[model samples]
Target: MNIEKFDSRFEILPIKEIIDENPTTKTFVFEYPLGGKPGQFIMMWIPGVDEKPMSVAFDDGKEFWVTVCKVGPASEALHLMKVGDLVGVRGPLGTHYNWGNGDHLALVAGGYGAAPMYFVAREAVKRGCKVEFFIGARSKDLLLYVDKISKLEGVNLHISTNDGSEGRQGFVTVLLDEVLAEGNCDVVFTCGPEVMMKAVGEVADKHNVASYMSMEKYMKCGIGVCGQCAVDDTGELVCKQGPVMDWKYLKKLPEMGKYHRDAQGTKHYF
Candidate 1:
């Protein structure tokens, strides 16, 4: 028998800076670029804490940033670090969103998902595509990237908060529905919570709009050797084949929004 193995060759780089987006979230900036595209993620190692995959929030050709939300031990450790701290970075790995020739694009984002979606919107608008951003959070305080996305010249921003403290009282999906009714979107892109992505997928399907979503999976080996991020029916690895997949293809995935397997492959309901 023969076997193959390889190392990720992670790089330890110093943090350029950190900007607090809110209490729970902060944007970590690094003076490095792996030529990441929108929707692609990098394995970020916090040394003694742990490593995790984080989506690229901002990449300006010279540097890149990842928006981290301190939800657990590893991330909380990162939250405590200062500007000059060192962290290991592995890749701009996984497939990214495919940009086609579309004039009008609609992006639906919830929670920290705005990071990657904002990246997409930035790149898209730069290519002359008019973007409409539908963003939602639990309340006004939790919404990510509102100020950043609003500054883009031709992009229109619509916001929603669960507590009715923002643009709309319900979900961002309501804005999606309204945008679809206006019949102007050529493509719809969404990221954030699984439930929000699932609902966005359904609405896109109903409106016959081409849609793409970034999936969140419990990734072990970010390069896909561990098989921990496999989507049940498709047998596709999120760390390898996606994080970003078309809505049409994802609708056929039985384990998409229903349940996802843990690191041990135990099914857990979302």
Candidate 2:
């Protein structure tokens, strides 16, 4: 939970603004530094609703935002929230992705995974790194932040969708092959569904490029107190050791891409 920097307690803050990014997703802006790294997440509390771990889509030292997609009950509640409403926020938790200065970065994201990868690309450009950004979703309307990414000077943007609504057709990993083949990418950072991230890791391994992936699980506690987010074999807590993990760490997890646990700790295979 980045315990040294943030405590387990929730800090209540008003929704400074909300911007609809797509039909299914909206960005909630809060006027706080958050002090989150590119791949860090926060547990958001909604009083009677629930608190869910979400990625920090943007954090500019002064304010931060999280992009919420209406996928379930908790997310739906977030979508229903309006400006000036107060919401509880916890740590900018978990380990974050890392890269060297001026390195060429390969950033791949799927669906709402584009949110944090956008943060990665933005920060990378600021460090003078050349970025090759690949964003994927089900269709054109589902793709997030492509316009803003295109405007970034050092970024070369690419898009892919499952139904070919825009850009190339098929999985975003298909485009990763081309970017890695160029032999300029220093590392690959990806997020989204576990299966997609597993595939991204495999591609990175094939190219012998280092890779880091963001993972999600059904967790009751954003802190390590609840073991719900622990992975197979090593028992590394996703709420602590990860949310972001390199291929070396993730490849050892027996359940990677195969199954995940529900809130009740029942295994659900993909």
Candidate 3:
């Protein structure tokens, strides 16, 4: 795959701090010039290993951040990067949430899904929209960013863990359903495993609320030219056309609940 368009690079900024989210997950905050939107992602390069897409966990222009769970080669390399170490970054790519039209916005996140949604919630608050966040993880150790997210204004935070280690003892979607049943949401946004997003989409559909979701797929090139990240029915190139898609339209995709192969050709089922 040709990755010329993905060649743009940012200086490797030193990591300022690392906060452990779980045994396998950590939030890395770095110093860098930033211009990213919520739901957008950055292509990170780990010196001789590989480059992968990561969502912006938080950013204040002068300082940028990402929450990475050590799941693979790229992520493990990211975990090894420490204070004052340089790491390559390239992008703020993909579409961001349009909080302009909504009055009450609800955000649903699962596991590392909270990374991108964190920025969305912050931006929504900045735009004067009331934001409610529902976050889920397999266990308490996997949940992250509670302290930081709690500080944002107008955010109603809800959490769930499968192991019942924190907050509610069920899935985050349960809380989402409850919130929707109360009929206070104008729009909904989500990012997580495809299955979780699909479930969230179903609830949003039932409530007739406009919804958007960030799709995660193996992306070799961050631009649209490569067909590596195509969506099921639409064949939409996620690199250029998405990562963020309207839930209503995404439901029409043929691969929604099926299976997809990872970068190393490992099959992952929804």
TM-score to true structure, per model: 0.96, 0.97, 0.92
* Candidates by lDDT, descending order: 2, 1, 3
**Model 1 residue 154 lDDT score:** 78
Work out how many backbone clashes candidate 3 has.
0
**Residue range 1-270, candidate 2, lDDT tens digits:** 554754578899999999989999999999997899999999999879999999999999999999999999999998898899999999789999888889999999999999999999999999999999999999999999988789888999999999999999998998999879878898999989999999999999989999999989887898999899989989879988888988888988899999999998899999
Clashing pairs in 1: none
Please give the range of 10 consecutive residues that has the lowest summed lDDT in model 3: 2-11
Clash pairs for candidate 2: none
Clashing pairs in 3: none
Residue 10 lDDT in candidate 2: 84
Error of 2 at 23 (Å): 0.5
Residue-wise C-alpha lDDT for candidate 1, range 33-88, written one tens digit per residue: 67899999999999988899999997887899999998999999999999999999
**Whole-structure CA lDDT of model 1:** 0.90
Number of the candidate with higher TM-score, 1 or 3: 1
Off by over 4 Å in 2: 1-6
The deviation in Å at residue 85 for candidate 3 is 1.3
